[model samples]
Target: MSGPVDPARIRDAIAQFGRTLGPDVLASCRALFGAQQEALSCAVPAAARDLAYGPHERHRLDLYGAAGEAPKPVLLFVHGGAFVGGDKGDPSDPARWHNGAVGRMAARRGWIGAVMNYRLAPDHPWPAGAQDVGAAVDFLRAHAADHGGDPDRIVIMGTSAGAAHVGGFLRLRPDHADLVRGAILLSGLYGITPLEPKDEEYYGAADSACDKSPLEALASTPLPMMMACAQYDPARFQAEYLGLLQKRLTRHGALPCSMSLPGHNHYTIAMHLGTSDRRLEDSIAEFCDRLFA
Candidate 1:
């Protein structure tokens, strides 16, 4: 007998549910996001701690770990905030997001979890965010041994706008491929055209801007990637973009593994990362293992 049903239909259903949540959900969540993050931190292992990178007034990274002598693979996480608002600190707000499921789960799995902050849009924008991530990756690789992390086994993971940052890093810094073994792009934006007409002034055009769409960048080199999104995420356009990427990769004989999580909303899909669900995290771990194998 056949197992279950068509994957496309399942994805469509999840998209429908996410749409039903309306735009207000994002707005409300943004309001109380900090508190949620604080509550979430309680789940982190006691050994987990935060660290700063670069010189004074430079970027900082929050590190998490489970107690043990064995070195663990590093998972570098970047949070989503539409390119404008977000921080690695501020546990009082869920919006701050220092201690989410990803952090907690990384600790539980005995992995070195590194979450860092990047420059925001309008002020920094495009290449700035990507550059920060690249710098952080390099910093981690250079110092991973001191922190009980395997520099060569680093994984770049991000959500929404953060995903865009990851994509940009992969495209712009191929020389650092040795540092980034793979990427997990979750609900990321690819093209600037998708921005509302009023928002165009923020990102400018794909032709002139240094932060052109990742899709355009991929024409040159495609990195090993696993892109996924929640079934209920309102950003269905992101899924469409992923489909385009799949086709592009296939045409080049380099398509990366991809998936759309079932019964998960945009927020919840990421939340499930550090949970026992194993649907997303397991796939990520499997990919990492394969990369090393």
Candidate 2:
């Protein structure tokens, strides 16, 4: 194994980009984190790639896990692209680094990591993302043992728009109560704030966004949750994080396991997962272990 990625440098680079989400910012983040992640050589050999979980062209997933005597717990990860785009692994890079590194991280921790891609927006609207999430879960549950995973010990995690989908899945698919053992949400919107134009593209009219929102359902869901947001997340995401915390506290009299990662922005919060910085990855592993235990 190599040394960890320098969190301070990643933090400094993101600080220079300012706290915003856009092409320029996202490109810079991809380049910076991509280089760091690639250098780590952390891509675990995947058991399967581009496996179809649903009929749609975008309904694909990759699985990563080492061979073991006992079936490993499952960790399913959903990537973010503002509801329009994002891939489980970089197609341009055949090595499966970048966002796919998180899957490798899970495999290293003795878990079966499944990274999936779902239908995008404009063509596929609200409930589609959530529906795809359910489909992916169904697929994983059915085929987990075949890929060295325990179907019953499953945790679902998502970042940004992907987090929104996971939240929606929990809300729209009440049956998730038995399928999903826990959830990890990083910087997801929960309708605490009005929808942006891009969000409207996926959620439909601004009027019905609330009805499609996952706030009320998430606050009452029985699934174990570990939530987090970057210190420099865009104001809306930060507010959503705080809003969920407050709602959970009010509704359940306690907050979920959560954190505000400092010296990092929204992108780095997920981007730095496979790097030397163990803050986020360690927390995720600990959370998954507790759920399976």
Candidate 3:
């Protein structure tokens, strides 16, 4: 929808991902998205196309993996758009990009990467996203091995709203808890309040929103967890990050593995996967590898 992004701005954006927060946290996402779209134009292709995970048309995933006879770990990724908008970008599109890049990141690491599409808010909402994540897990457990994925090492990862969904999975789908080997929450809104109307639209009344927030509901989870926020993430995301960390440490007596990417913002925390800025990428890959080991 936009023209080419400035290369310098992209570099500056990546530089900002792992730094301290500043005045420009909310101002840089659009530029970063433009830059990401350009960068994704050159990404490797998905090995599998739209494979349904659930009954909804959007309940689908794309797989990317290298040729391997052995079962590999899996990264089931969810995208963020304030819980309302975003997609598993068409790999065919040279102009727009999405979470598929993260899938490619998984495949490149000798894992099976899956980028998913969940029904959005105001139409399909809070529990819907959570439900979709559970369904994706079921689908993966049922078929990951057929696609060369080790069902035992499946990890759920998300950014922003998607991160909320990932965290919600631990809380919402307790029956499927054993299916998840680890979890990653990147720039997610856990229990940060003053629900924006749009967020309320997905989460329902304020009470419902509070009740559903993983930040408020999750004190301790058995799954290996990690939460990361970019240096330039929005104030609310940073707030939620600190709040979640404090809550977990107070309740569980230990903090989950966490990081603050110095040169990135909320968007780049996940966007930089498979890019030259490998700080967050390396951290996540290490986490997944260690979990499987």
- Best candidate (score: lDDT): 2
| Whole-model lDDT values for every prediction | 0.65, 0.85, 0.78
- Quote the positional error of residue 41 for candidate 2 in Å: 4.8
What TM-score, computed on C-alpha atoms, does each candidate reach? 0.78, 0.94, 0.87
Q: Which ten residues in a row have the lowest lDDT in candidate 1?
A: 29-38
Taking every candidate in turn, the Cα RMSD to the unseen true structure, in Å, is: 6.3, 2.3, 4.0
Q: Write the per-residue lDDT of candidate 1 for residues 1-293, one digit (tens) a residue.
A: 02333435434445554555434655443333333334447767434344556553437776777536867788888887677766654444444453245665676667887887887767765677788889889888888778788888888888877887887887678685667777887877766335653224335664465457676654345457777876667655455546656665766776667777777666555644653357887887777677644
* lDDT of candidate 2 over 1-293, digit per residue (tens): 12555656667888887677787777777776676666544455667889999999999999888658999999999998899988898534833465677787788788998999999988999889999999999998999889889999999999999999999999988888799799999999987888988899899989877789998888999789999999889899999999999989998898999989987788778877866778888888888889998
Worst 10 residues of 2 by lDDT: 90-99
Candidate 1's C-alpha runs over 4 A off are 1-17, 20-24, 27-40, 46-50, 55-58, 89-99, 197-202, 205-207, 219-222
What's the best-to-worst order under TM-score? Answer: 2, 3, 1
Q: Which stretches of candidate 2 lie over 4 Å from their true place?
A: 1-5, 39-43, 91-96
- Cα lDDT of model 3 by residue, 1-293, tens digit: 25554556666756655444333643354345645545544556788889999888999899989658778989999998788887876766642354678887888788999999999988997789988988999999999988888888899999888988887777877765589888888998887646877688789988666777776445577677888997777787888889888988998889989998776666667866775557788899889989878
Ranking by lDDT: 2, 3, 1
Q: Tell me which residue pairs clash in candidate 2.
A: 4-276, 5-276
